[model samples]
Target: MHHSLSTGTPLRVQDMHKRFGQFAALDGVSLDVKGGELVCLLGPSGCGKTTLLRCIAGLERQDGGVIHIGSRDVSRLPPQARDYGILFQSYALFPNLTVEQNVAYGLTGASREEARRRVGEMLELVGLAGSEKKYPGQLSGGQQQRVAMARALAPSPSLLLLDEPMSALDARVREHLCGELRQLQKRLGITTLMVTHNQDEAMLMADRIAVMNHGKVEQYGTAQEIYSAPATPFVAEFVGQGNWLPFERGADGHARVGGLSLRLHGERAAIAHGRIFCRPEAIGVNPTVHEENLFRAQVREITFLGNRCRMSFELNELPGHALLAELAPERMPHLASPDIWVSLPPHSLQVFA
Candidate 1:
């Protein structure tokens, strides 16, 4: 991971396969990234997102798969020969080298003057100006990460790969660096692929997300699409948070939940012991039901979350699973407990067969 995924044929991988004895890490995995697009390979651990990234970086040789970067079949090329910039969770900067020297590590053959100019430009680009003389040991965690980033971009590789880009930073610095990294990537127009298990980070930084599990991609779509129309139960529950209620199939495009008929988009499979999904935002409080899609529920709890409220409920029919609802500050009063009637649009409900 090569037919090009990027626009105008920037990169391509065909039927990529990687295996360790009986364990197949990547099972014919394929992906495309349009030029200048930032795609995140999102998944839980052991899903092979990192394995695929390394395959493209030419760091790990795949048992089978064709890798191409800009029309060159570089499947056999070593990591350095592929001309891709990579950043890991660890900065991996040399402790003895100064910031400028570390960033210029890949530019040794260049004249010292040229190397200095490139390093300075990269430092300024990453907001680490005036720290050229400091070594990795002397900088803060965030500063060293920026220096590593500067080093990755100093040579201007066609593609950038970040492995758990924010795993090493503290929460405060992570928030600040997330925006800075996204802006810098956009400014340079570098095609990028990052792997992360954090759903919030994926939503904030990815143009599109590919959710993986068990060495397979369970779902791939825009962050909105995966969250709104999760293809399966795994994806619905994985990306961000969602509340699901058990429902049994009813007659003619309907499922019965808590003795209520829930209209479905279409008839579900016979094996479809289904569940209805309502995004926390889709759950409403004390709304007059002028039509269908109404159910009785009891509010279990409500927690204040500053700008937003997280409301929890136990449905009359699906008492085993708790439902989460989000509300604005003004609606906090309506989040009271003890038996409440709620309505959800039929379209807002998602069912997996």
Candidate 2:
């Protein structure tokens, strides 16, 4: 079998728009995927992620804008002419056909020997070499998914589109397959676009993530970039766990949550009211060095999560407003008393106007 990697083609979607009746499914969505990179369209259901993937695959036509795959304008082309392979959520393997026949479904024009050789290569590539004689019904869900992947890659297309490909499997299986799929994609060097609502999967598999919301691309960047510095309130709330403390800008040009004044890292935006956003993990517990945002917090609840524990507490200075702090197992001993010192690092606080 030939293990040579194929060069990937870049994909660009320019100001794409689509709608159904009065509802806009894709509201001016646009993004770029570099060659050999895997970009994930991540969002909740009805967020236009799947629609955008369909538009790129030519299964759905856009009302405006252009779709380019490696310099070729494929916006108006048919699905067959797009030169891309797609894997659906259901695997879509023929139950009546054997694995070999299913993989060779796309190689209709090839001779008998060529089809056989290609089928063997694809099955081996997906780690199902000797299982080619089995039908789809005889395989496990993960095995069926691998068969679908083999069938999709048998054509050797430059672009691969995956639409929630691992959604059908169990949690453990899905996690394992996600790693396998990412490694295979990198090895093949194919420019790929995947639509997934699973944040863990997107963060684990994608080179970059496009977080979609309300039929629009909310933010697009690496996982760390989006998590650490979210561009919008929606992106911050949707991507990970966060603590939002509503604050009022005082007459002294400082922000305060209730009676306690807070210091932000960057220049304060000129706004009367905004929220102080911080991740649970960013809150420090009894730091060795003094911090600007340190305050005495009363422990309200503690949820132990094996490796780490989540402490829900309220600030002594600003009572009634509860905040959460995550602490490592080693730091749990410091919380011996109901009252403990916690610091919300100024740099960790994101002030949104």
Number of the top TM-score candidate: 2
Residues 1-353, candidate 2, lDDT per residue (tens digit)? Answer: 22334467999999999999998999998899998889999999999999999999999989998999998999999999999999999999999999999999998689999999999988888899999799999999999999999999998898999999999999999999999999899888989999999999999999999999989999999999999999889899999888998998865546778878887665763567888799999998888999877888899999999998998999998788888888897888877899888998888888788
After superposition on all CA atoms, what RMSD does each candidate show versus the true structure?
A: 3.4, 1.8
Which ranges of candidate 1 are over 4 A from the true structure?
A: 1-9, 266-272, 288-291, 318-320
Which 10 residues in a row give candidate 1 its minimum summed lDDT? 1-10
Instruction: Please list the C-alpha lDDT of all candidates, in the order they appear.
Output: 0.82, 0.90
Name the best candidate (by lDDT): 2
User: For every model shown, what is its TM-score relative to the native structure?
Assistant: 0.92, 0.96
TM-score of 1: 0.92
Please report, as a residue range, the 10-residue window in candidate 2 with the lowest summed lDDT. 1-10
Model 1 / residue 325 / CA error / Å: 1.7
Give the C-alpha lDDT of model 1.
0.82
lDDT of 1 by residue, 183-280 (tens): 88776777888999989899999888989887778887899999888988889888877877677877777777766777776434233566777788
